[model samples]
Target: MSRIVYVNGRYLPYAQAGVHVEDRGFQFADGVYEVCEVRGGALVDEGPHLARLGRSLAELAIPEPMSMAALAHVMRETVRRNRVRDGLL
Candidate 1:
């Protein structure tokens, strides 16, 4: 199965997932990322992880990529599409 990734509000095959060269995250590393573990098909410490992400974005003066609910949906969908039952997301 092709690995799926979420980018810019769309879910695409990993091979098709591309970030713009001018993206701040890629150019200047001006972004924050959270790695949440998945166990038995469920996220671990999801709330804390997201909260920390919000804080990080705030510290960096970056606008939120999406609402919390939307972000959560994206995370869950990505994990489901990738079929990751036990691994880091």
Candidate 2:
């Protein structure tokens, strides 16, 4: 299966993933990210990770790209698509 990456609001093939050079996240490093450890199809240390994401975004004065629920859903979907049961995402 081809790898899918979430960029902007769409999931695209890895080979096609692209971000505009002017995007703030790329140009000014104005973004926050969280990595949830996947274990047995579940996320580990999720709460703390989300908390940190929120804090980082707040500190950077950038609103979250999506809601926590949406972010969680996307994270799980990405992991599932990649067939990653034990990994950091």
Candidate 3:
């Protein structure tokens, strides 16, 4: 199956997901990320991971890409789209 990815505010197939070459994250690594594990379709330590991500962004003076709630929704949606029940997310 083709993997799905979230790019900007849309979900697209991995093959079609592309970030601009000049995007700040790509050009200067101006962002923070989190990799949370998914077990039985539930995120592990989601709260802590998000908190850490917020702190990292703050430390780097980078704006959040979206609200915490929205980011959380996206994370869950991405995992669902990929049908990942137990794996790193």
Give every collision pair in model 3: none
Error of 1 at 27 (Å): 2.5
TM-score of 1: 0.94
Look at candidate 1 and give me any clashing residue pairs: none
RMSD of each: 0.9, 1.4, 1.0
Clashes within 3 Å, all models in order: 0, 0, 0
Instruction: Give residue 41's error in model 1 in angstroms.
Output: 0.3
Model 1 agreement with the true structure over 1-89: per-residue lDDT tens digits: 99999998789988999999988889998778789999999999999999999999999999997897789889988999889999999
Cα-based lDDT for every prediction: 0.91, 0.85, 0.91
lDDT of 3 at 17: 90
Least lDDT summed over 10 consecutive residues: which range in candidate 2?
28-37
Compose the digit string of candidate 3's lDDT tens values, residues 16-69: 999989899899876776799999998999999989999999999998889888
Off by over 4 Å in 2: none
How far residue 62's Cα lies from its native spot in candidate 3, in Å, is 0.6
10-53 per-residue lDDT for model 2 (tens digits) = 88899999989999888987676667899997889877888898
